[model samples]
Target chain A: MYVSMRKLIQLATVAFATLVAGASLAADKGLTFGMLMVGPYNDHGWSQSHYEGGQYVEKKMPGSKMIYIDKVNPADRPGLTIPMVVDDLVEKGATVIVGNSDDMKDGMREAAQMHPDIKFIHISGDDVLTGKAPANLSNLMGRMVYGKMMSGYVAALSSKTGKIGYLGPLINEETRRLAVASYLGARYAWTEVLKKPLADLKFQVSWIGFWFNIPGVTADPTQVARNFFDTGYDVVLSGIDTVEATTVAEQMRKEGADVYSVPQDYIGSCETAPASCLGVPYYNWGPDYVKLFSAMQTGNWKPTWTWSGPDWTDINNPDSSAIGFVKGSALNAENAASLDQFIQGLGDGSISLFSGPLNLQDGSVYLKAGETASDKQIWYLEQLLEGMDGASK
Target chain B: MRMQGLKRHLFEIGLILGMVVLFTTLLLSLVGASPLEAFSHLFAGSLGSWAKFSRVLNVWIPLTLCSIGLLYAFRTGLWNIGVEGQVVMGAIGATAVLRLGLEASHPLFYLLAALLMGMAFAALWALFAGWLKVRGGVHEIFAGLGLNFVAMGFVLWVIFGPWKRDGIASMSGTQPFPLELWFPSLPGWRVSPFALGLTLAIILLTAWVLYRSRIGLNLDAVGRNPRAVRLFGLSPSRYMLLAIMVSGALAGLAGGLQVTGIYHRLIPSISSGYGYLGLLVVMLANFRLAPVPFIALFFAALNVGSIQLPMMMQLDSSLAGVIQGACVLSALLVFGLRTLRKRGPSDE
Candidate 1:
């Protein structure tokens, strides 16, 4: 091949640029982290929390590079699959992979088995407990039931109608448990704390099938929230993955309806409807992610299933907490102080909410008198507890 | 003249493909990424390893079958945008048969029944749109889109009201059929060889039907000159209806295989835009059956491999869609320029 003098010089320049680029990449010894989100990163809800957690890992761990792909579920991104995403991340030097939804369970498991050296932390999936999860795979979740209970308590305290509504997503065990925990908190505050009869307090829930609207499968959460407000419910607690509850409540408030909402997933969701958002029960994933990534850095990474609760002393702590209950602007001074006292009681182990003569929706006894439910029992709750008005199957 | 035409087509294809590469590279560089690294990661994710390549083929088989079927409708100048609805209806049909728990007595019989039922359901769905287009003078595009929304609603209802697991509905989909009813997989692989073989066979059958038969010629006449079909005493509407129904049947069968072979249950996303992707593939192939499968495979590779861009390079997967659009746009532009140059001022 005959090469001109100018072509040779051009080739030399390209080679030098390539060499510099390669050296810059090799200079970073930081552990690379990859997150696969089920929704858009700026969705202002579930996926956003995971996105912030990934960012937190970079800031806290120092020398760690964080990368994330949003809207990853196959249903949303039709052509992309989870195994492909996991494989690509591993090839890009990401040793710590986070699959941020239950839908990612199968792919996370398969990826963990295929790449044993990489650590896979699947959030909110029981595949680790139910399936023979690979050694490199772990399940990380929060005891959001406590945060949910606080939301219910705040709703009950703020409600002028004594009827607090919960905008629930689907009829799953996870969703059902969360709704019932809210009911428990509502009933406790209404009957004991407020010295009112239990019969006078109404805690109703309406489910919209999925985490968000699917047009046909799930009813629109916005309309559902409107319906709850229309039906005389003064406060609506969200159990879905969107800010529709608070946003709708804010609109209704502007229309001069005295209503409040509790948003879920991200702590900053109250900013979407400051006047109507009473509080938000959100997942604080930073502490958990840092725990996993720090272990990986020390070469002592071992996959351990973790389900941590919030530090009751400081629910808003950005670190050392799995869930946080951020009081929104709508919370009044009296209710806010009571909520703080309730959190202190919860942290000191003085409160026992699950202990009961609890009945399932079918009138079957779930917990006998004075019986305390175990973690396994709570994790696999099959139906809504009695005294809650909702469909439970 | 034929030799000249062949040479021109080859030249146009090469030029368009080169332009597509150039534009996509420019896009990557503009986003502060190394175009070489991005392209390499994409290919590696799609075709580098056996497992990864299998995933590409897994998407390719259904997309190709759907595109080949679409080629039939296009030949008759009919746009079958409702293929997605047809796929959903097919899945519902298969689920109806599979939920009967007939796997133990006669597995093969039930499997075949499910496949046929799926095709029947889709054909019927497509025929409704055809009826509206012919008798009601409605546009096929609008009719097909309306039916697609109805099909989605129908699937959601079935999942929530009828086939809901344990009387509770969620996005997890229906319960899996008995293990024996599940589509047999290739040993130690995610791809179902039987499904793959069946899809390829159907594609060949469509090709033969569209290219070798008198029916294909009649459909072409109806599309190009309806007056000729009337002169031959053939009903143009009938042929148009046949073309759309066949397209729907193929799309439906793809949906059936998806439920039985891959997911083993009908979710709301059972179709997952394979019908739409098939439309893109057919367009990219210039509406020709000969290149449909190849184009479908290439598109699938782009989509499945684009995961690498997001995972490794922090770029959105939508980059793949942009590349596909650019390729189609460039090819169409080349086609327009060639036609413009070929015609003298007298033609205009």
Candidate 2:
């Protein structure tokens, strides 16, 4: 008994010494955040925004250190499972982990359960603190739908055939609501504001399951653009990051389709397609990046959705307003005037995306047939009306 | 002398090391990175912490299992090259069970389904080669190669057609299997216990079976000369088919563990180059059981390290491919020299 007492006393001393050492280290250490990117930091698409966000945090916080790992194709299996990556990051001293993909939800959930001290912020997923997850795990998505609506107006105004098609990725809540916003915005401009008969307008929307070109599929935006133009829709809108849709517009120009295009990140699409592109609906992803991390630093970040978009201004706007590039390839006179009018109206808020009596493609009442939908209800949109061609359960 | 063989191996390892250094240096230079900086980045990225070591094991476990399995067939001189197909078919079988609601509440049933179905599926695929080799006097390699294309066709047909996710792009996968069915991720380890355990069991069992049994001696004779074994009253075809069966079963086990333990669903990406890598490993180890894991881990380190190198070095992940090709080439050179010396002028 006496020998055992001596061992217990020794164990207690080691525990106490380690505890005090940990306490001292906690105050001295810099806060480390990990960013898990689906593509290279320079991808210029989804990963670029997250990289910029990490840089924003680096600039904003004095003592916060950012570490990143990228090109984490979910297929690099075994130890590279998304959750495994999260666990490794947390184990390596990151207090907060940022996973920039929706497919990472299960991984984030599993990692959060394993390490309660580590906070995981999964982008564009529906899972948050309450159901099937804990307080440490949450999700955030930007309201790019508002930006998509603005792009829709650009297409609606540019269309000469009175028909326009929107090419989007996946029929999930994100793409579905964005597609709805695009059509609703266009119909608002074409029918309600222009005082045109509802039956005179034609709009179509289709979705491909992924964000970029699917090599073997007919869903390539460039191909879909030809589909729309051949079917008499002169204007095309793209909801994906790849420049395929704009490339299709460039192709259409070769044959005199006179079809216009709204490509997002308009300035950056040149890697593949050229500047016949109209303005893009780009994300001013800077604000939320600054806001969320600052809140995290102050221990004030909460599980609430923040929508930051629709800031239509010059490309140089600190908000980086989603700008439509003026038609670069010889904008013949009348088209220029039409494009400017659309831009000027959007800039002043004289044009609204959801001033609706949003009707189905079959002319059936969706939002009370003749009355406009409220700003609040538009944010919670669920389904696509008739002009859209996709389904989700 | 064996000492001469040792010196030759050492020289060959040096040549492989030189090739890898030159390979990465060229890649980094082309990407506008200083090769010195890229080397430092490679070191820092791969050996940066213990977590990275865990990532190495995650890759090592599966690769080791596959290499050891391939070693079995190579020992008996049967070119059981359909390992890739057998692995995929086996994974598809296990996933089909989960799709039918055979949940992991019955662990024994799940494990048995995984192993038995893997063996059965792989055996069925192997039967093609067996039939061709036995009945038509055909080469198993060509038959096995054709079967691989069929497996790939099967995977694509499901992804784009019937098994497609509703309204989702035809991404190469099924829904993640129910979590309860996943093999336990080892505590503080990225690899599943099932992978590590099964690989170890197969390595040990194979070493014992091939080295200690009388059938092993007959297999050696059959591999050396079927006519000699035929006069010895042994059926060489039976031993040859047995060797292929063992090879396919182990490869199928690897596939089932991959989908269930690692991927959580069948993915078009799962086979990767593991079966091919396994072939290189068997050749390098000279089909010895003891050194297979070490060789597999060396390749695994290249894979795990490549992910980190791209960011720090500005080099593409394909640089790992260059290093792997270099290693295999060097090992082949050493084997070629050893074999030539055995038939040198003195023997002639």
lDDT of 1 by residue, A1-393 (tens): 357878999999999999997876564457798889988788789999999998888888778888788887656677455766777677678888999877666667767877888888999877768766887888899999899889988988898899988898878777888998898888778877898898888888898888877665578999999999999999999998878888899998999999999998897899979888888889989988988777776667766778889887687888877899888988999999999988888889787688778898889999999999998888788998877888986
B1-348 in candidate 2: lDDT tens per residue?
A: 877756765566566667668876786677787888766655654556666776677677667867876766676687777878877777777766666654546764675576568667876777767667867888889888888878867865675566666545445366777777777765666666666777778778877887887877787787888888899899888877877777777777777777777777766656665777788877776676776888787777776666555544446655655656777776777678768877898753
What overall lDDT goes with each candidate model? 0.83, 0.67
Instruction: For residues B249-338, write the lDDT of model 1, one tens digit per residue.
Output: 888898888777766778888887889888877866778787788778887788788777766676775786688779778877887886
**How accurate locally is residue A76 in candidate 2, as Cα lDDT from 0 to 100?**
37
Highest-TM-score candidate? 1
TM-score of each: 0.85, 0.82
Each prediction's interface RMSD? Answer: 2.8, 4.1
Residue clash pairs of candidate 1: none
Score residue A318 of candidate 1 by CA lDDT. 88
Q: Which stretches of candidate 1 lie over 4 Å from their true place?
A: A1-33, A59-67, A94-96, A110-119, A131-136, A215-217, A251-256, A290-304, B1-51, B101-113, B131-139, B176-190, B230-238, B316-345
Q: Residue A209 CA error for candidate 2 (Å)?
A: 4.1
Kindly report the docking quality category of candidate 2.
Answer: acceptable
lDDT of 1 at A200: 84
